[model samples]
Target: MLNFPLWKKLMVGVVLVWSVLAALPNVLTPAQMENMPSFMPSKTINLGLDLQGGAHLVLQVDMETALKQSYEKMEDDVRAALRDRSSGTRINYRGLRSNTETGIHFTVLNPADVPTVKEKLHSALTGVFVLNEGTNIAVAYTPEELTKMRKHALEQTLEILRMRVDEFGVSEPLIQRQGDDRVIIELPGVTDVSRAKDIIGRTAQLTFHLVDESARAGHRLPAGTGVFYELIKDEAGTVLDKVPYFLVKRPALTGENLNNASSAFDQYGNPVVSITFDSRGTRKFGDMTKENVGRRMAIVLDGNVYSAPVLREPILGGKAQISGNFTVTEANDLSTVLRAGALPAPISIIEERTVGPSLGADSIEAGRIAVVYGFIAVLILMAIFYGGFGMAANVALLFNVALILSVMTFLGATLTLPGIAGIVLTIGMAVDANVLIFERIREETQRGLSPMLAIDTGFRSAFLTILDANITTLIAAVVMFGMGSGPIKGFALTLSVGILASMFTAILVTRWQILAWLMRARPKTLKA
Candidate 1:
């Protein structure tokens, strides 16, 4: 099997090369050629959070806000189901904690409303909502229940945030829910974290409500009621006082169904993010505006009304356009948010850090000197020990360097300081495999074998020793990647990649070079 026909072996080589090249772009960067547009992915390097310096946010998303909203919604459902209220009503939250003090209470226009209250609260808080039956109806939630709900919402919001960040097109982002109330977000290569913060922090909720006419126009609602506003601010040159206000309901028309949001040029070359929604959102939007034709609807985002366009006719199709004061980049970003839906709760940044470019440059220079010095010292030691075949082995060393760089270029991996260290150590390890093989060859030659037999015997016998050494080191790198954070992970990844590349170069590449040299040059005897 090993002595297969030349063309058959070459055919296999061609297939292997093609297979590697086809899959190479996924793992290697240098497989694709530059200056051609067919398959070249944007060769931009992905910088780490420390190197590129992006936003580091430690935010607490108030799950309590969602809880209050949930409770209020249930209360509203109860009120509506009661038909007509008894002229006046007062309801208060005697929280889960206050259950021992003052239980949940509701006073109606008449005390007769008390009996019906129990029936109504029972049906409304059905899902995971526990009711403690006593002389009076105690509609209290438990702390554990609240925690459970919060965790569910927190996990959900984290997934949603990941989708939103993907839409934003940040290179390598870290978004995960932390405990019960907070989320941690790290965006690498974001030049302005403030802009990202503003977008992520917004609720981006849309709503529709008529102006409460016939009385004080700008006056706020009563204490318990919330008046949702479309807030606005003026530019430096623009008049701020002229900004008008409008109202929208709390029931938000979410942008979650939006499938695509991209900036396209109008006939006049102005920028706009073309929008499209999913099937359900399309029907809901069309139904909402069908009856209220000619009425104005505000497109509210981040508490500000961006556009207030009148509904000339129903928009039955899932497609529409968002046009505002926007550059191409700004329009694209706005569309990204709209396509990903609104955030569950507004976020606030509590922490940030950055690394300077000068420091990174300094590290690179130091790493270069260390690698060069290390390579020279190893070469000197190898030459002194083995005399002639050590030089043949040195040829193998250069092949290892080529293989590692070729793999990196093909994989599109960003080179870090730690990654450079991994490559340097890998170069030294490459020689260790060759030294084992060379020593084995010498031992076999001394024990009465021809030069060809000795060389073949060396590689065959040395295979297991080389495999064991590399395998153990590879396992250590994997464990380091698992336990370590950030920079350590980079080192592990680089070392793992280096190990694979080194193995290929040390075994296959070195053997191929040696076989060609032996057959063509025909060395007479072993040089040990």
Candidate 2:
């Protein structure tokens, strides 16, 4: 075990050097890291929300809205499917209506049309179960279908939130589904709570609807139409006034048809969002523009009209631009939301808390003080207990610390208060390995074995014991990481990394130091 091969020596040297360099960024300021060369590693361990202090939001997904929207869409499909004249027999229905909780209800005018409509309803909705109540037929989602849809909605909502947060450039944001209909978001170092909430909460549903010029303001919208108030903002984003536009309930093209959206400048150097549509959207948009060549089309986002450009000619390219009175940031954010796609349903923040940087600074300082004092204490004790062997262990312990930081930085792991506690625990465990080895060596020395022989036998004997203990601890860390969340996960991560590093340093690195010492001094007696 004491015989270090050339490759092992080289590996140890390389790892030590690399770890120190990789861990350097963590100790440096943001300005210092930026000043570093591009090729050099400037990435540091990302601090968790607990350590950095940022936005904490608990959002509840509007599942009712999702279910209602689904029912409404199913209603439209049922109408389309039952209205087909190709079946030779006309299927008549009246009093067609959909309720949020009760689903879709429609009565067949003729009892003979019931069987035909039921078939069409089944064909129209994939997961719906249809029930016949004499002349009245009710369509609702099956239990299994509802469960699946709710799960999908939650998953899709999480993904959309992640994309939006990623576009916002949050350093280490945590976006995950909580319960069946809740989402938890943590934005580290995000001080602007209002902006973060605005960006995350906005549905950003963009649709192109034709402007109804005949409809007068203040008059209630007629059936088959809806009113969307367009905001008029001054230089600031605050709404000065709102002008209502009555339009057809159906949109000509929605953002769902968009393939991509990017922020760009218009011909006049004003910021705009350029969008590309998918094939189906291309056909629909092309036909719409061709048919409505002299009409104005309103570009609406979340029921607010950004622009209502007059359709001059057919847009066959599937590409269009949205120009409006927008700042660069606004344009970029809009493009981000468009590209990310709309959330499955609206999300309302049920719980919100803002963590201040002062608390983060205090936490960081406390963590720093604990680590420094604990490390120093460990170093002092290790050097004093086993003398020369203790000094060797101290060297390995230092490398272990550096290796932990390097691994965390490379993996982009978040560091929290519990993570620091894990490191301190690792410091003790690392020394424990050395203590076992040194005690074994002392026993070998008492047996009158030569210093080099005693060292080799001690390490070989201690190897299996060290491996067994560390491996078991490593397994625990793995389980912790897999099962835990947030701070517990952070703790597990650092603990796991520290265990591996400690094993390497204790078994390989410290042995190399002792072997080199033995070879150079040719000691006749062991010192422990």
Candidate 3:
């Protein structure tokens, strides 16, 4: 321990210098950071909602509606699969509809057609159960399948929501599942609450359907056909009027084929959203447009018609645009949702909260005072007990704090009030390692061992104890971080990082400092 190699000393010096450099930007103002050279590290620790006020939202996903929609789509697929003329099996079906409680129900025209229809549906639907009840057939999903689907929908919803929030430029937003069908979103530094909510809540389900001109008037349609109204709103978003459009119940194209979307201005300076499709969508769209030239194609979003433009020619490039009377913000939001993809299910805001900047300021100030006081208290106590050795421990403790902050900044971890408390706790624990080593050294010296021998034995003996203690605590911190949410997770993160940093500073850094002091002074009898 007394003799330090040249490379080891250089390694220690390099780490401390790099940590300080990485942590330097946190103390600088925005203008100062901007003015600094690009080579310098400019990353800073992200502040949580408690430290920087913003919006807090609790959302509940409507799984029932999602299940209903899934069944309805499945009903359409079943009808189409059964009506395939190339299958060689002739079957007739009618009254195809989905019941919320009974799944998809339809009537077979003949009893003998039931077996073929069932076989066809089984081939079409991979993971669903098909049953025949009297003359009616039902396509049902098992509980396990439904549960799996719901779980997937929740995970997909979280990803899409995260993408949307990130595109909105809300840095370090906390979005996590709270319960079976609920999510919590904390957006720090968001000022436009209404716009944020609107973006989060919109489903953005875009579809293309053909207009049913034959069902205009004096014509009776099929059982499931109905009219959908598209509302016209004023600048204030008040419903001024509504236009009714009759469309086939099934859509020719859906948002699932979307590849990209962006907001742009038309030649007339009106905002619109331009969209592009993937390869398969391109083929489908090209075929549809090629056959439907001179006919109207409805551009519908979330059951509302945006436009019904005549297909002048084949759009082979798979690109289209939706033009509506929209402001720049509305168009931007629409594009954002389209790019993020539609949510599998709708979400409703169950709770909303806003924290003021003044409160955040107050909390930050209080936390700073607490950390300063706790640090000073530890420094003074160590100095009084261990004399010159305490000064070395103080240096290590300071570096330990810097290392913690540098790692957090680099990882983009959010710092909350509980995180501050964890740092304060770390200050106390950091000195404990030094105290153990110093006490062991004093005991060795009392036994008439030389300073060099005592120092070596002390470090060697205390190493296992420190490792065991810190390792156990680190494990606990890891568990807490994995299982906890929000502030608890923040606290666990700081504690885990602090434990690792303290192990480095207390054992290696302070040991190097003491060895350097002994080599320079060459003290025969050490007081510390």
TM-score of each: 0.69, 0.89, 0.91
Can you list the residue pairs that collide in candidate 3?
none
Q: Least accurate stretch of 10 residues (summed lDDT) in model 2?
A: 215-224
For candidate 2, what is the total of clashing residue pairs?
0
**How many residue pairs of model 3 clash at the backbone?**
0
Locate the minimum summed-lDDT window of 10 residues in model 1: 92-101
Best by TM-score: 3
Task: For candidate 2, write residues 1-528 as lDDT tens digits.
Answer: 666889989999999999999999989898888888898888889898878899889999999989988887887798899888777988888999998777899899999988988887787679888999999999999889999999999999998999999988898788877879999999999988898898899888888999777777677666667787778888887898987777776788888889999989988898999999999999989999999999889888877887888899999999999877889988888888888899888989999988898899899999999999999999898877888888999999999999999999999888998999999899999888888889999999999999988998999999999999999999999999988877788899999999999999998889998888889999877754
Summarize candidate 3's per-residue lDDT along 92-201 as a digit string, tens digits. Answer: 87888887678998999899888888888898897799999877999889889988989988998999999999989998999999888999999998989899999998
Q: 1 or 2: which has the higher lDDT?
A: 2
The top-ranked prediction according to lDDT is 3
Cα displacement (angstroms), candidate 2, residue 185, comes to 3.0
Better of 2 and 3 by TM-score: 3
| Alpha-carbon local distance difference test for all models | 0.64, 0.89, 0.90
Ranking by TM-score: 3, 2, 1
- Misplaced by over 4 Å in model 1 are 1-62, 77-126, 133-189, 214-224, 228-232, 236-249, 252-299, 304-332, 355-384, 406-414, 440-461, 482-485, 512-528
Name the lDDT value of residue 66 in candidate 2. 90
Q: Is candidate 1 or candidate 2 better by TM-score?
A: 2
